[model samples]
Target: MWWSLREKRRRKMSSTHLHSQRPKRTMAQKSMKNPRSRSRFSVKTSENYIERMPPEVILKILSYLDAGSLFCFGFVNKRFQELANNNAMWYRFYAGQQAKKKNPRLIDEVTDGLSVVGIQERPEGYWRKQFFKELAGYNANWKKKLKAIHLYTGLPSQTAQILRSLRVRWAVTLTDGKGRESTSEQTHVHFTDAAVTVSWSAGDWPFIDQLTVLKLHGVVRVPLQCPDEYKPGWKSLLTKVKLNKDVWKLCGSDRLVKLLYTEQGITVGVWQEQREIAFIMVNLHYHQLVERSLLGSCVVQYQPAEHTAAFDDVDPEYGLHGYAAHIELHSTAGSIASGRFSQLFCTKDQISDGHLQLKVISKSNRSQHAPLCGSISLPWRTDALQGQIEGCCMLTLTVFDEAQIPFWCVSAPVAMTTSEQAEVSYDCTGESFFVRYEDAEGKVEIELRWMEDHKQYFMVSLIIFLSISKVNKHFGRDYLPQ
Candidate 1:
C-alpha cells in the first residue's frame, strides 16, 4: 500500500512538468489560418518561383516583347537586366528598326539571315550600344521652318529687275560630320524657279501676311529623297509636311536652328534688324551638306595684254572680239585655295550664251580652314554682240558659309560708275582695276584687269576679297518722349 502511494505522487509531479512545457503556435500555421496573410505569402512565393526559372525560358518570353518594352523590363531585377541586354537579341531589334525607316537600305536585308551563333559572337553590349545610338537620332523630332519674303510685291526697281531675272540650280551632297562629301546623282532641281510659297505650307499655319505671301501656283516637282545610309543629321531635308511641327534643336558647332524658305530648300544665313542682305540656299536636291574639304592655298591668275606689233598684213580692226572674265581665289598661304568653290551665277543684260563655267583650279591639299577655291570664266556668247560696248554689264559672285549656303553677294560690274545700287570706288593700276563695296554687313573688293590681244579684247581678271562682320546687340525698345 505504501509503494502504490509513492508511485501516484511521482506521476502527479510528471503531469505538472508536462503542463509547463506546452508549445506556441508557428508562423506558417498562423498564415494558413488568416486569409489575407495567405494571399500575401503566395505572391512572394510566386515571384521567387519566376526568378528561379531557367534562363532559356525567360529569354524566350522576353523575345516576344518590342525593343522599348524589353529595355524597360531590365529594371525588374539583376537577373532580368542580364537577360535584357543580350547582344544577339538587340541586334535583331536594331535590324527590325532599320527596316522601318523611310528609305530602308540593304543593311536590313544583309542582317535578316544572321545566324544566332554569329550574333552571339559580337562584343559584349555591342548591339545594345548600336541600337541606342540609332534610337537617339530616331526619337528626336525632325522639323524645318518655312516663310515667304515678298519676292515681287515691294522692292527697289533695280532689286526688282535682279529678282525677276534670277535663275537658280539645285545641288545636294551628303556629309559624314567629318570632312567628307557625296554629291547628288541629279545635280539640278527639275524646276529651278519654283518658289516655296504658302501653298507649299499647305494651309497648316496662318501666314504672317497673306497679301505679301505668294502662292506656289503650278505643279511642283517633289523634293529629292535620300536612302537610309545617306540620311542627314537634320530631318529638314526629308519631309515637307512636318514644317509646322515643333523642332528638336541640336547642340554643337553644326547646330542649325531656323531654315529660311526660298526657291528650293532652306537658306541659312545671318539676319540683321529683320533684314536679309544675302543668303545661300541649301540645294533642293539634298537634305544635308558637310564641309567638302579643308582650305589649303590661295592663287592668283594673271594674263598680260598683247601688243600688236611687227609686220602684219591682216587689218587691226576686224572679226568678232569680246572679253572673257576670269576669277582667282587666293588663300592665306598665297597659294590657290583647293577644293571646289561653292557656286557661280552670272547675269548680264547684253551678252548672249550665258552659261555655267565650273573649273576646279587646284588639287586638294591636307589643310584646315582653307576656303574652297575655284575659277569661273564668263565669256560673251560669241553668237551675239560683235563690236560695241552696250548697257550695264554685271557679274555677281555669291560666297558660301561652312554650311554651303550663300551668305554674302559680291556684285562686280564691268564698268566703274557711281550708281544708286552701291557706292562705286576704284583703285586702278597699269595692270588691274580694283572695285570695292563695304557696309556694316561685310567688305567686298573685286579686282578686274583688262587684257588686249591685237584688235580683240582677250580677258578680264577678277580678284574678290571678302570679310564678314560679327555684330551683336542688347535687346530693348527705344522710346521717344511724347
Candidate 2:
C-alpha cells in the first residue's frame, strides 16, 4: 500500500509541469514568423508613416503648378531647386502668359532669379521710356526681322530722332506728325496731317515704292522725282516747278504751253478739271470714231424721247452750268484699239442747249484734223427732264472757243440710269430735307427722311442694315432728349 501512493504523486507532478511549458513554445513560434511585429512590439505603438517616390515623377508634378506655387515648393528639396532654376521652363511659361496678354511686371518677377539663356534683362521702365535707346545700342549682328512700329503723335522730336537712329531696315510710321527719315531700307510713313511734307532725295529714297500725300495745304509744294524706270517719254514727263500761291506753273517745261492759262498760272484745280476733260475727250473721240467707221455701213439710230432736265441750284454760285450730255456706243466691232489722242472740245454755247458733236475719223487715218459727224442737238428743256433719268452718267463737258481750242472742261460722271429717278426735296424754311429714289429696273422705291438734330437720315429701303446700325439706332434713340 505505501508504494502505490508514491507512484500516483509522481504522475500528477509531471503532468502540471508539461501544461505550463506549452504556452511559452507557442508564443516563440509567432514571434519568429513575423519579424516586423517583433520590431513594432519592441518600439512604441504609433500610426505615423512616410513614403518616398522617384524624384523625376515628383518634378513633373511640380511643373504643372504655377510659378508662385512652384517657387514656394522649390525649398521642398535640392532636386526641386534645380528644376525651378531651369531657364527653358520659365521661358515657355513667360511666352505662354505673354501671348495671352501684356504683363511686363509679371515677366520681370518670374525671370528675376533664373539665368536666361539667350535673352538679357532690360532696365526698369525700358519699354516705356528707354526702349529705343536700348535698341539703338544693340549691334546689327542679328538677322533682319520685319517689325511694325506704333509711334504716338505727341512724342517729342528727340524720341523720334532716337527711333530714327536705330538699325531698322524697314519701318512703317503711324502718326499724324512728321517723322524723321532713317538711312536704312525703304520706309513707309502714314500720317493723318495732310499738310505734312515728305522731303527725301530720289536717289537716296530708292526703296520708297509709294508715297501718299493726304489732305494737304492748298499752297504746299511736294517735290517728287520720277523713278529712273519712269523717266520722261512720249507718255508723260516729270517736271520740277514751283507752285506760286495755289497755282502750279510749269516753268521749266515747254510741253505744257498749250495747257497754260493767263498770268494766274495752271493751278491744281485745273489738273482736276483736266481729268474731266480727258474723259470727255475719250467719249467724244470714241463717238466720233464710231460714227466715221459705221457711217456708210450702218444706218444711224436715235433714242429721240425727251429727257427730263436736272439742275444743281448752286451751279450759278460756283460759275458752273448744270448742262450735261449722254451718249452710248453700240459697237459692231468687238474691241476698240488703244491709242493716244488730242483733247475734246465743244462750242461754248453747247452748255445752254445740251448739244454734242463728235469728231469722226477712220482707223487708217492718223491725222489730228479729221472730218466731224453732224452735230447732236437735244431739244429737251431743263424742266421737262426732272427726275426722268437715273443719276447723271459721267459726262465730260468741255467748253472751248469757236476755234475749238480746249479751254475748260468738267467731268462729273453721274451714276444714274434711265429707269431710275432721284429727287431731293428741301423744306421751305431749310430746316429739314429728304431724298426719294426709284431703281433703274423700277422694282424698288426708297425714301430717306433727314433728322436735322442728329445729322442723320432714316432710309426706308428694300435691303437690311447690318447689326451695327441696330445698336447705333438704339443708342441714338435712347440718348435723344424728350
How high is the CA lDDT of each candidate model?
0.34, 0.27
Q: TM-score of the candidate numbered 1?
A: 0.27
TM-score of 2: 0.17
Worst 10 residues of 2 by lDDT: 275-284
Off by over 4 Å in 2: 1-32, 35-51, 102-482
**Cα lDDT tens digits for candidate 2, 45-158:** 454221154655666676687544654554556756655555444455555454344454555564435455343354322221222222223333221221212122111223
lDDT of 1 by residue, 159-274 (tens): 22222222211223323333343333221121112111110111122221111211111111211133334222221122121222122111101121122333222322222243
Provide TM-scores for the models.
Answer: 0.27, 0.17
lDDT of 2: 0.27
